[model samples]
Target: MSLQVTTIMLAVDDMDRSKQFYKELGASLGQDFPQFASFELAGGSALGIYPLAHAAADAGVPADGSGFRGVSFHHIVDGPEAVDKTIATAVAAGATIVRAAESAGWGGYFGYIADPDGHLWKIAAA
Candidate 1:
């Protein structure tokens, strides 16, 4: 069976805060609920935000874990400048820059940032 990732759900401590962060990153709000929210993304994919406790319960896991989760989301832009611009925008929206945009060994520019909930995102050039 061929599998495609259509949505990525993040467990957030505050729904409103998470929503606002993603909105600032240019994601259009989709379904919004007290415990869950979704954003419409390019290519028909989606980003979902859900309460930390509820998300953990749904997955039958504990919600108190911290530190790196060993996974990250990637945002690809058109060029190196776009990479820097995107990182700046995210920082202005309260995201902490883990790494400033710079030339990657792979021949592209990239950077990393962590959302309010410490979810890492890698912004890179296409």
Candidate 2:
């Protein structure tokens, strides 16, 4: 069997804030509540936000601590021009540029940005 990921649920401290963050990053709203929110991402995948406590409870484990761990979501594009457009759009939508756009070591154009809640996103064209 092959593994296919359909959704990614990030455990956040605040649902409303997380929801707004993903929305600004161009995700369409799916399901939402005081405790959680889900966004429709590209390729039929989903981005979800759930409270830290609840998420940990659901996982039957303790949180690793506050602040972001090293995790990133990505937006893949087609060319150098598309990379520029993608970065511009994400910036205009309120994402903070974590790293300015540049040529990647992997022979692509790439950049990094962060949502309001500090979630990282890598926008790239290969």
Candidate 3:
């Protein structure tokens, strides 16, 4: 069977704020509920957000973990200019600049930004 990941769900501290953050980023909203929200992304994939407690319960785990969750999201852009532009937009849309946009040693441009709930997103261009 072919394997593919279609969505990445974030366990956020506040549902309203997380929904607002992604909404401001122009994510097409979908499947909104009191405890869950989803965004229809480009292509066929999607993004989901829910309260941390709700997510923990769904996963049968505790909601007390902190620090890095050891996962990140990536967004590809057209070029270095687009990378810079996207990062800027993310900051304006309530993301913290984790890494300023710059040329990579691998000869590409990229940057890192964290959402309001500290979900890291790596914006890059090949």
Poorest lDDT segment (10 consecutive residues) of candidate 2? 63-72
Tell me the RMSD of model 2 versus the true structure. Answer: 2.2
The predicted structure with the larger lDDT, 1 or 2, is 1
Q: Model 1 lDDT vs. the true structure?
A: 0.93
Off by over 4 Å in 1: none
**Per-candidate local distance difference test:** 0.93, 0.82, 0.92
Q: Would you give me the overall lDDT of model 2?
A: 0.82
TM-score of each: 0.95, 0.81, 0.95
- Give lDDT for model 3: 0.92
lDDT of 1 by residue, 17-124 (tens): 999999998899999999999999988999999999999999999989988899999999999988889899999998999988889888999999999899999999
When 2 and 3 are scored with lDDT, the better candidate is: 3
Write the residue-wise lDDT of candidate 2 on 30-69 in tens digits.
Answer: 8878887889987899988888899899999997665567
Per-candidate clashes, comma-separated: 0, 0, 0
lDDT value, residue 111 of candidate 3: 95
> What's the CA RMSD for each of the models?
1.0, 2.2, 0.9
